[model samples]
Target: MKLADKHTPTKEVKYGKALGGFVVAVNISMLLCLVTENLFSYGAAFVSLVGTLALFFDVMITLQFILLVLEIWSRFSRLNAALQDALYPHCTELFVGASPSYRCSLLQLQKTYVALGRAADHLMSHFGLPMAFDIAFCICGATCSSYEVLVKLLSDSDVPGLSIGMPVSISEVWLALHWLRILLLSLSCAAVEDTAAATGVILIRASVVPQRRTAEFDEFLRFTLHGPRTSFSAAGFVKIDRRLIVSALTVVVTYLIILGQLTFK
Candidate 1:
């Protein structure tokens, strides 16, 4: 996909590796914390082992989805940056104008971007349900724990007693950590769309030669803006944030339904 002479994308590659490693570390830390909590609270190694395995499964499920999203994002960013560096400021690569290699590069990039969009949709289709439930569990745990602490504090009505069974500060910190996790997850998902859309803008400038441009350049730019899969939203309806909200509501409704059934029984 090289139209102009340039060095390898070592920087972006390094960044992706670093970010991936960081995500793995953070998630593994979370898994270990859960396993440790269960071990101490239950005093049963088998129970903790089972719970650890379950959590580790969920972690892998969600982690793979997240890693794919990051990969798509990094690719889009790399594409845009390469386009800019090749044809920006002085528009130096204007001589490559109408060349087959240049056109082929653009065509290949467009195809790759479309493939990315399809992959995004597939990711949503394959892992979306599990991820939604996994996140819902986190939110539910945070909400329930906070409610328990508040209720107990109100009943005891004293700082020392409130801090006895559950350390008040630690509880607050734990709740805050989950909330932060949710926030970061949402933001990272959003960046996919942002980076994907920027590709078209870069192409418009990179492909054009001031006042002179070819049909292929125009077509690619137009395709970018109006293509079926311009970005993460191939259907224009697969927004992660919206899905997360729907997932949250589903979780709440199911909880209520179970409570109702149990009370009636």
Candidate 2:
């Protein structure tokens, strides 16, 4: 599909707008609370306000990453649908001399698959740098957030004081949200990768139908089998999949443990 045709941008746009609005409102409300508390006690809420602002940006980036995943998922779904239609054409006839309509449908499917691939590539290129930044941000955020939660639970004194004007529970909730975002991002990447791989399998299956084994079929099979496959990576270091979640958790836990040791010392 052409760029214009690819981006319907109705539902996704609305979702992004809604998320941005909500984040802004939350940040503003927290800032107001912090200001009120600071007025009562000079310099008491400064650290908490700064931490809240950092969290606001972190959450905003996470939400934007989620939106990118949604867009990628939608594109992959469209590609899969086109592949399915190509595999099983509407015409009931299965003989070598299929109807002209079937031929046209197959041609259209080929064009669609190519267009979809280009669109996916464009999206990846556009989001590549941002994704790298997000990965780094998430790793650091996860480490700090996890360590803070651990300290809160173990220490008698609340030295960090992350929740100055807000309830103490909010700090725990924020950490949970950070972890949840990481998990969802990993799952979304895996889903998109699987969907693209499924198209390749479907093409291979379609190519093997004994009733439809022709030179053209062989050529299309060869083309598809040799084409570029879809995959996702994080900052060029690790692939994004279910395994990534486990790996990220491991890193977070290791950091938390190291921090705990230092704190005790």
Candidate 3:
């Protein structure tokens, strides 16, 4: 699709406005939940109490994941384009020996790619596992809460020997499977990034020093340059914007911590 058709200015404005509104709503909901849970904990109805808590935690986690993915994807795509532009013949370094900026830019791009790959790795290792656990926990919590409601209703029917300590439900298993799907998606991303990082580093080192160091540089370059795969053909590391990565991950971790306080305690 054409760029204009894909991302019109008006569409961007609409999305930005919607995002701001969503953030406001999220903050308001969190504050309200905190206040209600504390001040009128006893007065709140069971359904409202359980549903609101579930929703609050789920939304926070979902938002954090979405924001992180968007941030990484957008920045990575930009860096990819920048590298493509830099590699063009017209974008020559005027003073190859003295051009620190040229080398720095290339290195910076490579570093960003590495950062993206690292972030992807973290997502696969740490966040992915936690997300799976969280999904299971939330599902189990919901099932137990539902059983509590059901048991309470049944107790009022004058049943004599229908006593169960807690209901065992299979919702957690369902959620665990869902979490597995998400993990698989992230795992695919991680594998791609791992390959990119490994190959990029080798290529970047070879590109930097062809004759002075590394006997295999020539052979490596020849293979990489002529490789059928587009990704392996590239010379530099993936360029990621550190500021964006840090900011996104910070937001994610912060929200997760806040969510923990709001939920577990």
Candidate 4:
């Protein structure tokens, strides 16, 4: 692919719509959480309603992703076509204005488009759609751990002088951690903003001027958002925060092992 163009009309409109839809989905999800706040008080009736609604929201999230895939696919095709066209006649002088890999940068972004496309496809299947489940499971575990810690803190045998237990409820801890988890998830929107910014810059560049020199530089900037793959190796993982995942795993494993031993013993 040529890897050098600043604007894509189809891509811009499609992704713009995807971003809007995702915003709506997130708002709806938050609303569901708010509505269920009083559910625990109602006991089984509340539980039944909340559980069914949760499943429905999960399905809706899946649909949001399907739309996302379509949006990305439309952009990727436009990019591929544009780049392939650009690569031929100007092959020799193409990236000469900038560094060679500067030209390769567009190719790299194309690769990212392909990678995300595949990931989206896998997400539509049975096994790959569990990212939401992972989010849910982590929230559940964190809530339970917080509640257990709160209980132990209040018990005289475990920690003296903290026995104001009557006022505390398990749901309070659950709600607090649930809110925090969602707040953290919102940070990922920062990534979307970066994507939007890059899309805007490139599209403007492509539409107004398709000149070789500036286009190369624009392509270079576009590829900055696509980090390298193969994150297991030393240099490969440098940009990624592997420690966060490692620490999370350590906590979950230690908690599970201790809980199991204490239960059986």
Estimate every model's Cα lDDT from 0 to 1.
0.61, 0.61, 0.43, 0.46
Q: Which ten residues in a row have the lowest lDDT in candidate 3?
A: 230-239
lDDT by residue for model 3 (7-93), tens:
211123224346545544754554454435443434457766676676567556645654554444444555545544444432244
Best by TM-score: 1
Model 2, range 1-265, lDDT digits (tens) per residue?
Answer: 3542343222243354564465456545644554454445445577767766766676666566656665566655665665566557623445656456545555554555566666556666666676667666667777886776666665546545323333334455555555666676788778767876776677687765666554555655665678876667654667777897888788888988898888777
Q: Give the lDDT of residue 256 in candidate 4.
A: 58
Instruction: Please give, for residues 1-265, the per-residue lDDT of candidate 4 as tens digits.
Output: 1221234323353355665566566656654554455354455786768665875565456345434444444455465445545543454553354356546655555555545434534433532335455355554656455546555554646544444432344445444544434433333322333343454355444433344545544554445345332111112222212343444545656765676455436
- For candidate 1, the TM-score is 0.72
List RMSD in Å for every model shown: 6.1, 5.9, 14.2, 13.7
lDDT per residue for candidate 1 within 1-265, as digits (tens), equals 1221122243364477888888878877766665556566666788778877876786677777777778767776776675565345446554554566555655555566666677677777776667667576667866655655564565576434233365454455455545545554565677777777787777765554753265656776887888864233212333455455455546645765664354336
In the predicted model 3, the residue pairs found to clash are 109-239, 112-239, 112-240, 113-238, 113-239, 113-240
**Candidate 2 Cα errors over 4 Å, as ranges:** 1-62, 89-96, 156-168, 214-216
lDDT value, residue 235 of candidate 3: 13
Candidate no. 2 TM-score: 0.70
> What is the alpha-carbon lDDT for the whole of candidate 2?
0.61
Clashing pairs in 1: none
Q: Which model, 1 or 3, shows the larger TM-score?
A: 1
Q: Judge candidate 4 against the unseen true structure and give its global Cα lDDT, from 0 to 1.
A: 0.46
Rank ordering of all candidates by TM-score, starting from the highest: 1, 2, 3, 4
